[model samples]
Target chain A: MGFDWAVIHDNLPFLMRGLWNSVQLAAITVVLSFPLGCIVALGRISRRRWLRYPATMLVHALRSNPLILIVFWFFFLVPILTGRPVGDFASVLAAFVVFFSAYFAEIVRSGIQSVRRGQLEAALSTGLTYAQAMRFIVLPQALRSMTPSLATECVIVFQGTTIAYVVGMREFLHTTFLVTERTMRPVELYLFAALVYFVVCLAGSIFARRLEGKAGIPR
Target chain B: MSDPLVSIRNLGLRYGTFRALEDVSADFSRGTCIVICGPSGSGKSSLLRCINRLEEFQDGDVVFDGASLRACRDLPRLRSEIGMVFQHFELYPHLSVLDNVTLAPRIAKGKPRQEAEETARRLLDRVGIGDQAGKFPGELSGGQQQRAAIARALALEPKLMLFDEPTSALDPEMIAEVLRVMRDLARNGMTMLVVTHEMAFAREVADEIVFMDKGRIVERAETARFFSAPTAPRAREFLDRILHRL
Candidate 1:
């Protein structure tokens, strides 16, 4: 296998475009999942059995399933059931959104639960409603504690965008594969793809560490 | 001529298989401090929590300023009127001291932000840590945190305040500052029921002191009389053990 700087240079713009699409998907998915995760967390922790049982079951089922299976189910199942063709990007995004949302919900639920019960009681005894206490007190603290886990989830979902290639939605890995097919240097192309994922995950880990420091996570 | 500000009758609280408090009954008149003292696991904290419905007692009645806590719909209003402080200064760590004190007032009492902030400022000053308003709970000393916890409780202007071993989490030096704040509240005629092992604070500030053992009130008397001459042997032994530690 030969190192072909020219081939790599030629594909850089297309790869960047694909990378941007992946990043956009991950970013929007993060924003979307956060509130959804919070709601799911609240539901799981609710006093009413009606709310808690179904929410817990949904989260448990999602968590137990593989990300690929989740993507396949949403992508294939939604179109079959609805009789409407959702766009490729939308299907991929929706699949990952649902997958990461359950993961993030577990993060949120544990974070909030890890906080002492006395804190919630204190908030309530002050006359705040359950929603008010959660909004003003519990969620803020839980978000702080859950930051590292949430960031890790973002990175996981970012890399999981590689799975979109399986569904034929051209992403970072898919773009690289196309270039490699033309260049015909499989080893070199795979190494370059690895490098891209490494740099992105490394950058995310560093950013998450900075956040942990700022939030005063105890050593 | 009027009902007590807080009343409990036949309260029996069970946590799973264990009964924390059982068949406990008490009445609290307005504007007096009631000190509850007991050995560890004696249902002192559980009793205080039951009054505010922080812990649900399976078979009992908690009437707070004439509202029944047994009814689910009335708990929020009842809880609003009855504030509680915990052993740990359960201040919201993410918020500033000002936000900690003001949040419930704004959210629960529906006070405007400005009014809440102003009230929070006043209460913070009353606790002698007004300068710490913008600081988070983690930044304050344990005593300051506990005092802020009290101020946070005060922000709602509760008709009754319950303290569940508030000073137990504090360092020796820190306990005094929190007790001073409690003393000040008592002086101003705040209606308070405290579960504490701080015998000095209890004796100095409490109008009535109730001693509990094994989920029941063993003795009840005025603070001086109870400390001077506890009628029950359990109360006497408990006081002796406490005095030995102090």
Candidate 2:
């Protein structure tokens, strides 16, 4: 009959492990997806139909659907392609990678477009090949301008990691669910999970805003 | 004018229904400074862009050095041999001025970093921005940025250079410094095709003045002769209007 905070105290270590898993998942996704997204951005902006069409379709498709649907789609899709029942973690990760890359691709493509056309013209007239010019000149300016957007995407990625819990991936929110079932104190555990998510995401949002302020200065 | 560097043979271009260049032809000779000047929509810039193949034509070709631009397979090589400076500086803002100049040589020509830096410094000094090499382009003034842009094009060690209204974007005070660098380049026998409104520079340095109007060459003559007695009424009226302001 008494409201007890003891369940959260007793399960701190287990909950921390869950948080650690979330951190690892977000970190891996950020690392894998940003670079992949840059390629997709280039492909989306490319003049060639072969590269542009698929890249544009993927970005639009992933952007329209909810994260959970993507998780389920890949959940079923990965097994069919791999010809084996891959782990739930793998499916969740594939979902996150595919989903977040579309967001990042949009960010990077805008950054690329923001650079003036004359910059590309100057680079081309120098006889540097198109790829070389993008690598040496355009990307350096674009990626710098993209820093704030990239940071915000990263924060979203961290928040979105909670979706992995739907697949029974045992991430932070799922660990709270596990503790509530055992202790029969769902109210305390759910509130604790919410507080944790809010605190962490707020800090990330603050950092991204600071980057945006500084990015305004032409560097 | 006997030895030609770029020969435009019946070059024609159109944008939708509007013809940008109509059977435009000119032979730019080696070691000579040719100034192409006309009003805002005379296809002067289009003719310049065609030589570098930046603007492709539906009919005819640009023959640079010896090869025809339309038939050439190695575009990068051809472009490298011919340098172009835009109206805006278009310097790589992220790179230091030194790096901006050295980039083409180091990456495109495979020059060693040390060798490229040396040449970059020499050219930067020639353009009077020797001490500004370590600075980013955003840190420099408009005149300094344009000079750096000129040096960047020169770093390719190109046989021919194209100036597409290089000083048009500069403040009036800054124009003279850029024109000075260009004059120095001309004096050093760097064959250049200049598109500018600077009649003083044209009179002082141009071997010949090419006047275009409505996508056709209306008049072509020696700079002194063009200035004194332009045969075309359009060319005469253009000179009168532009010179009246000065």
Residue A167, model 2, lDDT: 86
The candidate that wins on lDDT is 2
Kindly report which residue stretches of model 2 are placed more than 4 angstroms away from their true locations once superposed. A1-3, A216-219
* Cα displacement (Å) at residue B114, model 2: 1.2
Residue-pair clashes, model 1: 0
Model 1 alpha-carbon drift over 4 Å, by segment:
A217-219
Docking class of 1: medium
Give the interface RMSD of each candidate. Answer: 2.4, 1.7
Q: Write the per-residue lDDT of candidate 1 for residues A37-61, one digit (tens) a residue.
A: 8788889999999999988998999
Per-candidate Cα lDDT values, in order, are 0.85, 0.92
Candidate 2 residue lDDT tens string, B1-246:
576899998989999999999998889888899999999999999998888888879998888888989998877888899899999889998899999999999999999999999999999999999999999998999999999999999999999999999999999999999999999999999999999999999999999999999999999999899999999999999999999999
User: Model 2: which docking level applies?
Assistant: medium
Model 1, residue A56: what's the lDDT? Answer: 92
Model 1: how far is B70 from its true place, Å? 1.6
